[model samples]
Target: MQNDIIKCGLTEQTDSQFVDSIEKEAYVWYEKNWKHDDYEHSHHRSQLTFVEEGYQYFHIDQKIYLVPQNHIIWIPSGKLHKITSEAQTVNLMVFLFKSVFKDDFYRDLQVFAVSAVLKEMLLYASKWSQSVTEDEEQDIFFKAILKSLPNFCKESNFLEIPVPKDERLIPVCHYINVNFKYNLDIDSLAEKGKMSVRSLQRIFKNETGITLQKYHQLIRILKSIELIDTKQYTLSQIAYLVGYQSLSAFTSSYFSIMKSKPKINKK
Candidate 1:
């Protein structure tokens, strides 16, 4: 019993150090899997993050990104971001880049669909102990993969929802999130939050950079992604669960955001 307690203490210490290193932007953090909760930090080097098993959410550039499995998220250097997940085990792979590549694509955040080719390339590159290698052959292979990212990752994902900056709209946003599995109209949402329709529409758009209707759609679709990842329900059931009366509406919303068909992202 004492040994178990000591081991847990050590784990907590390691996790704390991990956050410190990341905050200083001095670490090249990559592993086959990690058991962690939502924490905010940044890195000196750019990152290519993919989830092989479970889904995770990222709060970046004041937007909430739902990164379901099989999707790749590109984070540029010095971007303050926080990651969160509810899955018991999140099997993720992160590739850190010490040197910035010469591409405008590398300058901003992009979460895109991971092609089979890109997935194999990322997995193969994961063998390296260091992201910046000195071995001539390995360096050449790595450069090749880096150069090919733009070609392989052309489809831009739309899973991003802007985070609210207005304090007044917090409860309103919460109401939409909590009741996303129902037909939530703007008038009712405004009434629930004790705001006029005009004020609610204007403030929501200003703070979140999206209208209340769009925000509602995003929340519902985001919930559906989580439900789909569980693999416990059928697509029809998932659509209904997320408050879509018809599977067609759910599919349309999902494809609009994810740029792909809904399926479990497993090889």
Candidate 2:
């Protein structure tokens, strides 16, 4: 694979007595600069990608998911997806063999909130030596991680920008992605897509699984999230930049989408 990050693989072998067992393996990547995989690919093993710093954008299931710092994206085995990293991103991806998780429990791609404990555990797991044996102390730690996986896993309520397969909708999706800061309405978007307002609404709902207004709202909130920690911009400025006319309305909408208040650390 063509990547800008440095990657390493760690493997654990089992003794002959455990012939039925699958070997435990992990591939760790530390990304520094921005990069992207424009093509889709799938892995035989399940993947847990953790964002330690910075953020990443993932294209999966015809939707765009913005994975910010401290979040985890759980990709099931054989799930086709692509990823683009933001500048100075440092992330780790743990590739687990099929036997690591039951099929029913991890059959789809998901985003999860990472607790402090889970973060530490993932860090520790990434450091396991290649000579790791089945009975080592790390083995017990790995087992504990496996036991805790189900409890830690959850579906994130983050903003998802669904991309429709229809070619006509491509221009509309692109417009929302690039010009989210501008005033946009269904009628204007319909005109841009060269379709009637009702046809645009129907096609957008059918293709993206979200109404046009909600999708626009999601993009605005997502943009605010990206700008929250910039320090150069005040909360009010950030809100206005993302198309919200009122700070109160922006805060309310932000809290609704992010499930938390926006933290500002201006200098």
Candidate 3:
């Protein structure tokens, strides 16, 4: 049965608010549930998700990302993806439309390693949510959070997953990067890696803190984002190119993993 606790769609703004002298609307939500569910597709808005507590996973194409505390996920506009989390997960999510920030400054989604100052900013924003009167202060805090994002062009090893030094999983990992668009499963991947499925599962989790399927999903989603960002393809076309047959199916799966849709820039 499909999980229904987590709802998906565009976030609504009850009122227009400006942050950091930037006139952009925002949506903040706090949820507790067994899982977060959403459809796969692209959107016109960029998003930032902060995981304060509990375990969550993001499937970006074929690579599975383990989201724990003190980490943020940035989803650029028009990138199709989805997100799921275990029960009792608390998150601070920020959404921004393209028209809000300056072109050069806020052109993409960036995952920033949380800093002490940024943490405090999130705390303040949460508190401010209880009182609408703190608009100015809230705006300041939100702007600071946006400014803290690591620019996409900036090279930072911190933004990457730590591929364990395990020699066994190396081939599996390499194969994933090379063949993410192909239909693959743990059993096939294990055979390709020359290991038993159970052994591969245990080793992968032990090394990457995520299962083999999840790892592949993350890589696939990330690659999908890259294609959307670099090439000109319709959402439907992208879905098939990435191994999804039905556009609706692809969109649903994508949203379930990326938490936001792929951003497509107009030519």
Whole-model lDDT per candidate: 0.71, 0.68, 0.58
**Which candidate achieves the best lDDT against the true structure?**
1
lDDT of 3: 0.58
lDDT of 3 by residue, 1-267 (tens): 232222223442222111232333544444434345444434555666777754456666544455545567777665666565542434544434343456554654455456677667666666544232336665666666666555422322223354756787778888888988887777777886689998888888887776667666666655665556444688788888787787787777667565545555554
Best by TM-score: 1
Which pairs in model 1 have colliding backbones?
Answer: none
Runs with alpha carbons beyond 4 Å of true place in candidate 2? 1-38, 93-95, 129-135, 264-267
lDDT of 1 at 10: 19
For residue 134, give model 2's deviation from the true position in Å: 5.9
lDDT of 1 by residue, 60-145 (tens): 87788888777788888778778888765577777666566778988978887788988887777667633332556556666676
TM-score of 2: 0.80
Q: Per-candidate TM vs. native?
A: 0.82, 0.80, 0.46
Clashing residue pairs in candidate 2 are: none
Better of 2 and 3 by lDDT: 2
